[model samples]
Target: MASSRRRPPVEAPIAALRDALARIDANGPVLVAFSGGLDSTVLLHAAADVLGAGEAGSEVESRRSLLAIHVDHGLQAPSADWARHCVGQSDTLGVDCRVVRLEGAPQRGESVESWAREARYAAFAGIAEEVGAAALLTAHHADDQIETFLLRLVRGAGLDGLVSIEPDTMRGGLRVLRPFLGLPRSALERWARSRGLAWIEDPSNRDERLLRNAVRRQLVPVLDRVLPALRQRLPQTLAALREERDRLRELDRRRLETVTEPSRSAPGRAAALSLCAWRRLPAASRAGVLRQWLALHGARMPSRARLAEMLRQLDAPAADGLEIRHDGFVLRRYRGQAMLLPAAERSCEGAASGFCLPLRWVGERRVEVPELAGVLTIERIGQVERVEPVGPVKPVGSPGRPGLAERWLQAPDLELRARSGGERLRMHPGGPHRSLKKLYQERGVPSWARRALPVLWAHGRPVWAAGIGCDADCIVSKGVRYALDWQPLRRSRPASAPERSQH
Candidate 1:
């Protein structure tokens, strides 16, 4: 059992809240993540004091308004009670409050702590978006930061992990502020007691089975007694680590931009890395670049051994369809380019290849092909001045693929489907038909991506391919024309998953 005595209260917590709120770039509604714990109770109180009672239209006078989001993960039986307590506390303070109850528990083989944290933040993000919040405040204090550092250190974390908690940072597009990072937990407890505030003690905090609980209970105290100055020194050390981390991150971003490009398969949703350019980087820089690239696609950081293995594989021959799976994503190397794709995309392509999507060419602007995970856009390019059957179509604009003649495109029987074997396109009138396999090989399209590239068919013959130009037979020397372009949906990623903390 832990002692219940509280230290003398100080004015530091309120000052810290004011400073933190002032630093945010935007001015709008702010949300306090209230957990009904001593740290959060103090944070909520301080927030209400600084930002006012958060009535409707309060933002008109005060730059920002306040509200409380109490996420009930429901991991314990008393979670509902804790939520009620948070609402009661918020109401007493005259702050608007909402209780979000999280559904489901940790899946098999998943960490309860990780699941809880991810689900909790996900819920917060949803509410913040709904309320148009500029920032979300958490009650992470100096002690929590110290605990984080020690946990990461003992777990063999790298510099990114060792940076511990950041005072201001973006998570899942939400600005998360930790005003209490500079204040000790004891200060919060003292403030709560001084004001006679009430809070809940999470029963799971006593469960040493959780690594964080064990560290806080066993290791933090031992370190505190052994080195009385550790708390002060550790924060300085962490701040320096964070500075170095930011510096390296900037350097890595510059280097990454040179080697990477928008994914030709799923632009905006995924990225493509040029293997040749990436290989030219120094060994140390390569790891950083790879880590950053994986992050853009929502992949958690790979272990040192795992990252090393990925590098080793990249050094090998550029094998089309080479895949390395990690955290619900598949990193694939195809056609001298490395791509990060959602695991589902890789697994389901085989089945999707055999299905034919039949549709009419009714002058529609876009056709959504869910099975192919992309959209087929047919844009009218106006009248074709002249068709050079012996040569490729003249460039009308960017993405200048040859246009399909509107007269020929109006045929009743037209379908869009994945590539089947032996498909060929006649590049020019009276020219020898070329196999799609050979054409894809010439264009450097990877075998894996070929299955999903939607092919437009008319009168039982392929008229146009998504990434490739249309058949010359489908073009007219005169009259209206429509260009074919396929845009694949952004590679899907898990919307809510533990990030930065666990894989």
Candidate 2:
């Protein structure tokens, strides 16, 4: 049996910090995320004490050099002054400091805290990249982690969100180190006092209206009194959850790799998935796979409810036109595969594809069609050259067939129009003409994607439809030739097609 005597409070936070630093084992200069607050003031001082004053040069001394970065969100009236104060404090510790002033006001519907955090992290990433720093240090302590955990819990977050904050993690290509995560806020305050450190307090911290502040003030005090062991217990729970989350993520990664098909047009994009295999997965596994797929494409994780809805839609019949739109991406199910496309691309679907606009191709290399949300490129090809079709569209002619004929390419002014209706294209020379709708159907082009496809017309006659390629009449001949290529552009536009261009 162990003795039950209470231990005295630690004299300094330096020991814990040094232990944290040792665990990090970074052999490069570190940038401290200084905010002129008690927590960060203590972090900056301890870092300065351990690392020494000036920049460290040798590999052995690299961990000893420290730099401070202060991001002025300018949301509060005293934000500018706070930045200055941070600079002054850094100077007192003989540490190099940089101050970044953010510009522009938060957009409507955007919260101040969210905007500030985004701006702050972006600034830190930029500075870290510029200085080639290996790590960016923040002063998030145990109390802050508890507050975050509580906030996430109230919001019905899952394991990932519950353990979102970690002591060390990579962000924006740099290691984000939270050395004081194991220490309490009171310990940091005591350390600051012992070192005669002075720091400014942000007035916004006292605002209970903010969720974080409410948790920190009202919820934390109550928890401290009723369940004093929560602080210690929560961290242990988070650590266990983190390990479990990582193990699950690794499993999800392997599953995702087996089912994912890479996009040809967009690098780093997930183009399609095996519907059969996806449907066989358990509901939770399906959701995990979807989350991993979206993350691979650089999309934010949707809420649990939203993810459930997405999975339901993905499992629905193909005729249902199952496409679920989320904050940054759209889960599109077509034919027998699943695709995660940018939300902007969702507008290109449906009845909007019927709207038509015509543009003159004046021998330029590229033409930007804002209405279609894509660009068309005109490139000359040799007689023997064969141009493959883009995306789902198949090649127009037989194997080894050339692209658009040189004569057609030289047409004084060729018209590039959108499919309106009742359009006919001769897919083979001397062959019967077929409706554009039938051709699109035969090519497996999604109905929503047809409107965005460019149709090249020569003398009021349909010569080629992007994706389907040049018509039989426009096949490349034995002379100078060119191929018209269409590439989609990413932009924020209405689902409805733009009004007819005056040109």
Which one is best on TM-score? 1
Lowest lDDT 10-mer window, candidate 2? Answer: 494-503
Best by the lDDT measure:
1
Residue-level lDDT of model 2, residues 1-503, one tens digit each, is: 88899876544666666666776554667889999999998888778777766234312322456889998877789888898899888887678899999998777877777668767777887777777776777899989899898888888888788885788776535677787888899989988887688999888899898889988999899999999999878888988888888889889989988777643223224457767778777776887788877766556567678888887777776633776786556776666777776665556545345555555455687887766667777776556544444323236333454677756655655677777789887765577788888977775666666666778777667777777677766665466666667776653321111111010
Worst 10-residue lDDT window for candidate 1 reads 494-503
Question: Runs in model 2 with CA error above 4 Å?
Answer: 1-32, 44-60, 63-69, 87-111, 123-135, 170-175, 209-211, 218-233, 257-269, 317-319, 348-371, 375-417, 421-435, 455-465, 470-487, 490-503
Backbone clash pairs in model 2 (N, Cα, C under 3 Å; residues 3+ apart or in different chains), count = 4
List clashing residue pairs in candidate 2: 51-64, 350-448, 353-451, 381-481
TM-score of each: 0.86, 0.72
lDDT of 2 at 94: 78
Query: What is the per-residue lDDT of model 1 for residues 1-503, given as tens digits with 9 covering 90 to 100?
Result: 98899955538987798788877778679999999888998899888877766334332325477889998887789888898898888888788889988899888977878788878888888888888889899999998998898888889999888888888877766788899999888888888898788889988789898888898989889988999899888888977887788789779989999999766544335669988888889987988988888877667777789899888888787566578898777878766778877666666688776879778777789887777777777888877677555565332235544578886577777888788788898876888889888877766667777787777788888988767778888876677778777765654323342233210
In model 1, which regions exceed 4 Å deviation? Answer: 1-10, 54-63, 261-271, 317-321, 360-366, 378-390, 393-402, 405-414, 429-432, 458-461, 475-482, 491-503
lDDT computed for candidate 2: 0.72
